[model samples]
Every structure is written in C-alpha cells, then in structure tokens.
Target chain A: MKTYSIVLLLCLLTPYLGNAQENFIFKKAYDLKVLGRVSEDTSHFQRIDSADLQNLPPAVQRYAKFSAGMNVVFKTDSKSIKIHWKLKKMNTLWNMPSVAVNGIDLYGWNGQEWQYISSGRPNSEDNQMIMVENLDGKMRNYRIFLPIYAEVKDLEIGVLEKTTLSPPDTALVPSSKIAIYGSSITQGIAASRPGMAYPSILSRRLDFDFINLGFSGSGKMELPIADLLAKIPAQLYILDCVPNTLPEQVKDRAYPLITRLRMLKPEIPIIMVESVKREISNWNSAMYTRVNGQNDEYRKTFDKLVAEGYQNIYYISTSELMGDDHEATVDGTHLTDLGFMRISKTIERYIKDSIAPLQ
Target chain B: MKTYSIVLLLCLLTPYLGNAQENFIFKKAYDLKVLGRVSEDTSHFQRIDSADLQNLPPAVQRYAKFSAGMNVVFKTDSKSIKIHWKLKKMNTLWNMPSVAVNGIDLYGWNGQEWQYISSGRPNSEDNQMIMVENLDGKMRNYRIFLPIYAEVKDLEIGVLEKTTLSPPDTALVPSSKIAIYGSSITQGIAASRPGMAYPSILSRRLDFDFINLGFSGSGKMELPIADLLAKIPAQLYILDCVPNTLPEQVKDRAYPLITRLRMLKPEIPIIMVESVKREISNWNSAMYTRVNGQNDEYRKTFDKLVAEGYQNIYYISTSELMGDDHEATVDGTHLTDLGFMRISKTIERYIKDSIAPLQ
Candidate 1:
C-alpha cells in the first residue's frame, strides 16, 4: 500500500518536472569553455570582444569583431550536443556568411588526433538551433573553432546529464603558444569550416596552441593591432602580413611591427613568411609584378633583421607555400580548404623547427 | 568633318549596342557543349532524363535528376564568363540548398590540371547570375561540373562578345571510357563545389571522359538502372555501391547487376570499392559492425567473381581510403573538401592503372 501510494504521487508530479526542465533550457545555460586566449575574468572570451571593440580604428574595428581564426578547447563526453548561437553581421564582398558554416565547426579527439564531429547552422532566422544527436558517449577531447568571417554574438553548448567535461590536456593546449598574425588567407577566407583553416590545421597536426590575428583585407601589420598582440605572452611570433601589404607599405610597417613584438617579448622565436604567389599571377602581368615585388620587399625585411643581429628569427620563402602545380587556391588570392591543407603540410617542418623545446 | 561625324555617330549607338547585348543574354545563348556522356540525340543527356523519368521507380527517379557527376567541357577565348542557372531542389539534412554552390563549379586548365576559377551561388532567388570577369584572353580550355546533389531545369553559358568557343579536343574527350555508379559519397555529399567531387577529380586527373551514374541513396545496384547502364558502351565499369547497401541486400543485388553488365559488355574492366570507413566508427560499435560487415561482403563478392574465372575484375580495400590518423571527413561520414582530396589521392593509382593508356 505504501509503494503504490508513492508511485501515484510521482506520476501526479510529472508535468511539473517537465515544466522545470523546459525553463532550465534557457535560464540555466552553460557558457562554452574557451581557452587559448587571456583569462575571461576580464569578461573577454574571444580575442576581440566588447572591451576592445571601441578602441579599434573604424577601418579595422569591423574586422576585429569577426572572430577570424579563433578557437576554444575542452573535453566532454556528451551523448548529444546542441549549440544556441547567432551569426555575426560581418561579411566580405567575396564571401557569404552561410558558406563558412555560420563561422563555427567542432571536432573531437579519438585518443590520437582530431576528427570532425559536426557544425552549427540552421535555416531559420532570429534563433538558430543546431543539434547533433547520437554521439559516441566516451570521454573525448573537444575543440570548437569560431567563425572565420563572422562573429558569434553568443554561444553555449548543452550536453546530456552527468557527462564528464574537463579542460584540454596541457601538452596539446600549451599554456603558451605560437601567435600568428597575417592577412585574409591566414584569416581563413575560403576554408569550408573554421577548424579547417591553415592555423587550426597546423595546431591539430603539430599538437600546439595558437592565436590567429588574421584580419581579412586589413591585416597590414599596423602598430596599433600589434600593440594588443604584444600584450599576450607567447613562445613564438609568426608574421604573415606581407600578402596584404605593398612593397612600400611593408618597408614602412612590417619591420616596425616586428620590432614592437620583439621589444615586448624579446628572446622569443619569430618566424616571418613571404606572401604566397597566386596561381593566376603567373599569367597576369600586373599580378606578377605585384607578387614578385611583395616577395622582394619581404625578403629585404628578413635580411635587415639578420643584419641587426636578431637571434632565432627565421624566414619562409614564397616558393615553399604552394605546390609546383599551383592547385592551392580558390580565388587568385584566397585559399580553399585544399589550399589550407597543402599550406599546412608544406610549412609544418619549418614551423616546428622554430618552436623552442618545452621545458 | 566626315571623320568627326562618324566617330560621334559611333558613340551615339553605344547604348543601342548595350541593349542588343542584353536581349542576347538568354535568347541567342549557346547551349554549353557537354562531353563525357553518350549522345543526347536519343533524348538522354544523363542515364535517364525527362524521356524516361516516368519509367523509373518513384524513389530512384527523385534522385536521378540530381545530375550527380555530369560535366561539360568547352574551349573559349572570351575575356569574361557568365552563367545563368536555377538550382534543382535536392538537398540533405545538414547541407542546405545554397550551401552546395547549388550544384555547379567551373575551372580552367593551366597547361596541366584544373585550377579552381570560381563557384556560383547568387543570393537572390530565381534566375541566379554568376559572372566571372577579367579572364585570360588567350584560348583557354574550361570544364564545368554540373550539380552533385541537385539537377538543373535549364542552364546556359554566356561569354563576352566576339570571343571564339569550341568543343573539347577529341584526345581529352575520348570516344569510349569508364562509367562509375555508387551512393551519395559517389554523388559528392560534402565537397565544397561540384568540380571537387571524386568522379570529376578523377576525370580531370586521368584525362578521360566518364559517365557518372551516381544516384544519391538509391545505389542498391537495382536491375532497372543497371539495365539502362548496360546499353551504354564504356571501356570499364566501376561499382561503388557498398555504402548504400546492407550485407544481405549486397548478397542479393550486387552479383546480378555485375552479371547483367558483363553479359551486355564483356572484356570491360570492373572495379569494386569497399565503403570508406568513418573515424567515429572506431568507437561506435554499431557503426563499426555496419562498416566492417559491408567490407567483408564486398570482399566475398570479389573472391567469388575470381573463383568463377572472371578476369579483369578488381577490388579496392578500405584501408587505403583514409589515413591512419583518420582526419579525412567533415562529419563522421561525409567528406569535407580536404577529405575529397585525400580520397582522390588515395585511389588515383588504382583507378589510373585500370585505365588503358591514352592513345
């Protein structure tokens, strides 16, 4: 009689329990854990967020919010995953918001390397919902890449009950990292999804962490942006801003930005890259002049740095960036997903050599 | 005074010329020359078009119109290229209609292989426009891949005025060639655009014309479609239907289709493929069972064929499909553009050797 009475009371309260669960969906949402940047106690989860948006110049301020080549790492064992997020208003003349997976993609580690899991995009507007069901319910490391050409207004990850979640292993997600700064190619102009971008590809293959300071057409190595990057501590600094700069501009700005970074983080390893030659440029005369000039100026800057007795600074030439067959780009300037894969494979050895051994 | 008057009259007629050009956009447009298929004079551009759409089972007919791997090759000296097209309404769960470039991408030969020039997806609805400007003025060979997951109601290509256009060379567009039939992977589920699809990639790399008979989920080696395919003459037959079949279904359907094709065209090379394994399947036991079971049955079919004294039948094992690191997919099953590249690389050697050397 006692057991029957208890069962009757539980059935009577089922509707109230369902209502509680519904309310909790939005009211008690968990913020997705983001690493590879400064602490969030300052209320900053992305590289460029509310605090610094106002400080940027109007020209680059728009790109600053794009969340280009940003990443977040953690570990989770969720049976299913849901992302409640909004796409940023950011867009380019050549790229659309939807083609970039609304600027987010996720991958999970399979005890060895990262494997793609899913991405977030919904056809509906205002409130987009992306739900991934039937995940392998095992303890796996997870990584989420932010949009390359768009910003995330807000994003939260929902997991099933009692799924064990933790931070990434320190070996892979190093406390300090190699920081990369460059133009649209480095910002992942045409990668299919955010994580497939060259920087993210390098991070996955080499097992390291990085901050991509790629700013689409505007990554001209301005001193103001360099000032913000200098504030962060990293083991190596990679400068890839030659593509967006003219020879005259690189002569004026590239060395100064490198100088500023070196002063702030002296004795750190620095790797600078010449602009990747566009495949079409081989035939287009005007393009050939521009590409060849960019390489000449970038090499000049490297020579100047060496002459000044700069130690542990390195350079990667233009020929090494693309294959001899030249099947590495979507447009003449921007990289496709295959371009990113080829570039990461081409430059991995040079990139790895520049890294100082972990203590 | 006469010379001045003539120049003034010429300037006055410029708007009229512009209006004439506008009228010619669709009215005087040239039907894009399609290669790699049997003649459509029998009113069949694909395996089955409007002529026989009524005859196919409702389920298979729904997928037949998607134009899974159809390609058109042409040469033009036009300074600019334009495409006017409408999207076929075939779509998948996660991939949107607009996400797949709505089934079209174009590339130009750069003396060796295909270089991605551009892909088309106009934001506006109905009568989308894709205009590629400032192309090299010299005669350039071009290849346009039709939709992988969608079919077109009608399509036309427009080049700049006074440019020469011609059909592909006979050497490149061979008289007889390979024909491939398979599932959605064979139908290109997640390539960034149609040209990157494996069949198209193989077609370009091997320099051989092919008829791509990949239907989305209906590649169960049904006798009806096989009957239609058997009528077409090809140098080789490639069967990649393992992904869309259960072991029991394979045991029942695969052999009959092969036997039928053999009876129709003897002494042709037939290459069978095992389903490409997914990275997530390593831990998902149910998925592992499905993938492994499919492979076992496929191998069994190959062994049985050899035992029956069938010569020139080849089998491609699954281990070659993905790298040991297993980072070759977009989701657990669908390939990203990189995955497609890795796959095209993995199987190119086998597929190439099967091709009789180009005369």
Candidate 2:
C-alpha cells in the first residue's frame, strides 16, 4: 500500500515539478490588442459578447467563437521562447487535424519580408506549452501565428528568465486592419504551419494586421455578422464567403454584407472574391455549375454596387487565383500550403493597387 | 485491497467497452512482405529479410525499415473500411503527429485517377488501431499509404463482418513496378496526407505499382543501396536522392550507382533528377549556389552515363519540376501538395516519353 501510494504521488507531482527553467508569466498583449487582435473578446478566446452571443442560433455562435488568426505580437531577448495555450475543447479522435491546427509558427521580419524561424509544439500534457530554443538574440521583429481551425481558450507567451521582452514597432506591421470574412479555406486548412495560411502569409508579405473572420462551413454572409463586422474599424474588407453558401444564399446575402461594410467604411477597399473552383469541377459539370453560378452572383453584386455609386468596391474572379494547374487543393476544396501561397500571391497585386495606401 | 484491484480491472476493461462498434481486427496484409510481417517478428520493423539487410550500413538500414509507400493491395465489398496499425514508438507531444511525422492516408483507384478517401487517427491511446468507417459497398480498389517519416510496426485492414475482400486486377495497377528512391520530399513530408505525396500521386495518375524508398535524411546514393535496389525488377528507376546529398557526394556516387543499375538491367529506363530548389534560394544566393551546383552534378553524371552507351538514361532539370514560383514548398525546403502535383505532371511526361509507352 505504501509503494502504491508513493507511485501515485510521483505521477501526480511530475507535471507540476516542471523543468529546471522557472515558468514565467505571460504578460497581457496591450499593444497588440490596440493594434487589432481579433478574438471575440478583449482577450484571446471569445468571438462576440457572451450576452450578445446567446441571441444567435447555437451553431453559428459556436462556429464564430473559433479563434482563427487572433494573434499577439511581442519581442523577447531570450534565446528560448515557449508557447502556452489550451483548447476550449479538444476532439481527440476523427478527422485527424492537420499539424498546423493547434500549433504555433514563429516568423522574424528580416527588414524586407517575414522569414521562417521555428515552430512550437505542445508539451506532454498538450494544454501546457511547447518551447523553442536558440532564437537569434539580435532583438529581431517577430510574429506568432495563431491556430487555424481550433478554438484557443487562452494563449500566453514566456521567455527565459531575466530576458528583456519589448513590444515591436506597430508601424513595422501594416497600419491598416484588414478584415477578411470567409469559409474554411480562408480559415486556413492543410497549411503545415499557421504562418503558411494565405491570410497569415499575406500578413507577413504585405505587412497587414489582419482579422480572420473565417467560419468553417458556416460563413454564409449573415446580416447580423455584417452588422457586427461594421462596428470594427477596417481599412480594407475582403468578402470570400462564396464557397460556403448556396447560389441563392449568395445572391441574397452577398450584396447586403458589402452594403453594410460600405455604409461604415465607405472609402475602404472591399474586395468580393469568387469561390476558388474545385479540382473535380473540371470534369464534374454539377460542381462547375455551383462554382460558376456563385461567381456570377459576385459579378452581379459588384455591378449593382457600382451602379449605386459605390466606387471603392472591387471584385476578384477565379480565373487564375489558384493557378491554371488543378493541384492547388488538399481535399479538392481546402487550400494546402501551395494553394495558400498562390492565393496570397494573386491577391497581393489587387490589394496593393486598390487599398488606402495606393489610393 | 479490493478497491485497488477493482480500479485496476476497470483500467484494463474500459477500452474494450468502447463506443458500440467494437474496434475490429486489422486484416493481415499478405502482400508487401517478402519476409513475413515483421511486426510479429519481435525484432525491428522491416519488410525485407535481415540477412540481406546487413549489406547496408547501420544508419541507412534503420531508415530503410520505414514503410513510406509500401502498401498492400486488396479489394473489398463491405460498406465500411477500417485501418489498424501500431507504430514501433510514439511521440506524444506537439506538432501533433498528424500531418508529416506519422499519419496514414487511404486512396481508391477510380479507374482514371486516385481519389482521396479519408485519413485515420489513433484511438485515445496513440498506439491503438486507427479505424476508418463508411466506404463504398462495390468491389473497389485501395492503396493504403503508410507513414512517410515514421516506422510502422504493424498494419492491417478491417471491414464489416462477413464481407468479401479479394485481390484486385493486378493490371489495373501500374504493370511496371516503379522504384523511386529519394529524400524526405519523396517520403511525403507535409503533404497533408500520404496520397498527395509526389510518388503516390504519380502512382495513381499512371496506374502503376510503386516502391518508395525515400529516406528522410539518409538518401545518400551509397553503393550498397544501389546493389540492393538493382535486385528489384523495376520498369523505371528514379534516382531523386540529390536533395539529401551534396555536390561532392553526388559526384562520387552518381555514376557508380547508375553503372550498377545499367549492368543489371540493360534496356530499362533510369531517370536522374536534380533536387527541387528551395524557396529562399531566390533571394539567398548561397542557396542558389547549392541548388545550381547540385544540378550541375546531375548533368555531369547523365552526360557521363550516356557517353558510355547507357542509352535509356534520362534527366529532369529543376526549371520545370517544382515550377518557377517560390510558393511550392511547405518550409523553404519541403514540397507541398502544389509542389507534389507539379512534380508528378512534369515527371509523367518524362516517364511516358522516356519509357517505352510514348516511344
């Protein structure tokens, strides 16, 4: 009985004992929050207000709560950095989430573009933290990409003891808050790491602070969502929710969402994206119909908006967004890392030409 | 004492009393093994004989045991299909082990191309059998792609009770046993799933049986590996080991390996490949130097081989293999799905034109 008790005690105390390095506290990201970290709440996890959240239907509210692309930027002088976070909930089995789903990717701004640094993994007890060691100590600029698919309940960052940590020049990041509302692909699936997601890639490449309003399977452009989105101050609004809605739903909701955005931020660039065509659609005419019809709605809506004297509204057709080759998708729908890169590259030109900076 | 005994008993019994559909037994893969199923061997997990294995050095021998594209072919009539496999060891921390290091993907041959079905995740315990349910009821074909970067101790298939599972048309698969030997990219690192790997994609695209001898960091073209690879009766031998080897290593091993291959199979085609260049190489000139120098070695070896009257030897330059764009890789180094697709398309033409079919 004594032996058994001793074994159980050791098992219980093992995790708490930790490594030689004392775990430091994760400071509040006050600067990044002001720059526009788009979690539902002020912290890292809520989508909308808990009171306002209840008014929506159960499914939409649940989907909205997912913390996709909600990241905080901070600088640390330590050679070792660690990520600490817990899921709102975990799906242990089924679907087999991609590597980037719950992982965090770190990128350093090398004066020009964001270069890859390292990835952090969860500890043995997954909810604890994953640590990365041996970062270059030259006080380089850094970005910690958030989870793509999962809902992060809390996120904290820690560096080695006595290391100086400071906030980066917010000017180094894009001055504009770029709000992109879309579906699963936009939420960033099949990317090997979070930084590889199109939006995340664009954030690094184009130097934009971003709001990923990508709701997997449920990002049909609802009026309530549009109303809520209008409250946030954005320099550019990207509507890419075509893939999740039916042709009829797109016809009804697509224009209203843009109208709402135009009402609040009339001069900002609002780019309406045609659903990226699926690989199977080339052979399957039914799939072709769905893809073509959805894009047709985008063209019609853009024309209607333009006729009404909405000058800043723009449109992107799917002609070459994913490239001519049919190898861009993972499951014929979601973008892989390659697909994400193509999307980022294709979108960069339009963004540069149309946004506030260019205008 | 009684309470302790009861608690222990429950721990053992809980997994068995799992969700209603009891995890069925994995059907034995009678094929894919020349030496009996090594999982049961109580030795290291190897698909080939230990006596022949001693010819290679220790490091390569350990890598050779990983079952990358090694699959067992079978047809089934059940409405559901399940996969059961155990890893020799498990990593229970971050990066989650779902995308690259260890994961399984199922592909079905739909007469023309290989279609993606589903991916399997382990049960609560990482080592337990992974089950995939709800497959088509018709007599269909399947290729269960094994882990790309991990060792598979055991693997088996499971169908619903009393369902018919028979051998597929051997001709429906590629008649030419294509032996491709390369590095981690060939082993499908970051492909989201196993079937999306270049070798696996090409197999489905061309309807060919394949042997993927891609070792992550161990693919140095050693004489022992060439001696062993010559033993297999391959229609075409793809030597893509350049990515892992340096220019000096290539200069030393390139001609000798091809010479060994030419001596064994005089008429068969042998395609030598330049390593797909990294994304960072465009700006980072040092990277450019490495990639350029490596391809130069490939050109040199191919020239030397052809001059010696080794006729069926061919070479693919880096220009078209990974595409001109820098967005094809997951990391700067590893190819993503887009990269894989581009590679397959580029190689397909070479395979058909260089091999007897196009001629």
Provide the TM-score for each candidate, comma-separated: 0.83, 0.68
- Per-residue lDDT tens digits for candidate 1, residues A93-210, read 3322253645467677767777665555434323333334445787666777777666666666656666755566655565566678887788777676677778888877775567
Q: Encode model 2's per-residue lDDT on A1-359: one tens digit a residue.
A: 56643432332112112244655656544434323344335654544445555544466677666556655667776655666767665533122233366666656666776666545443322554424343456565666776666667666677777786677766675666788888777777656666777777787766677777776665778877776667657677888888767666778988887888777766778888888876544433334554577678878888998998888777888875887655565445667776787888878887886774655
For the second chain, the TM-scores of the candidates in order are: 0.84, 0.83
Q: For each candidate, C-alpha RMSD in Å?
A: 8.4, 10.6
DockQ of each: 0.20, 0.11
lDDT of each: 0.63, 0.64
Name the regions of candidate 1 deviating beyond 4 angstroms. A1-33, A42-44, A53-55, A76-100, A120-140, A168-172, A357-359, B1-32, B42-47, B82-100, B120-137, B356-359
Badly placed stretches (over 4 Å) of model 2 are A1-36, A39-41, A45-57, A63-65, A75-98, A124-136, A153-163, A278-310, A356-358, B1-67, B70-177, B204-210, B216-223, B241-334, B339-359
What is the DockQ score of candidate 1, to 2 decimals? 0.20
Candidate 2, residues B1-359, lDDT tens digits: the string is 56643432332112111224643545665543211122223344453446666876676667677666655567776656666677766433233235334656656667665555545544422444322333446777766676665677766677667786666666654555778888777777656665677887787767566777776665778887776677667788888988767667788888888898788777788888888876544433334565566678878989987787788788898887887645566445667676788898999988887776534
CAPRI tier for the interface of model 1: incorrect
lDDT: worst 10-residue window of model 2 chain A: A9-18
Best by DockQ: 1
| Candidate closest to the true structure, highest lDDT | 2
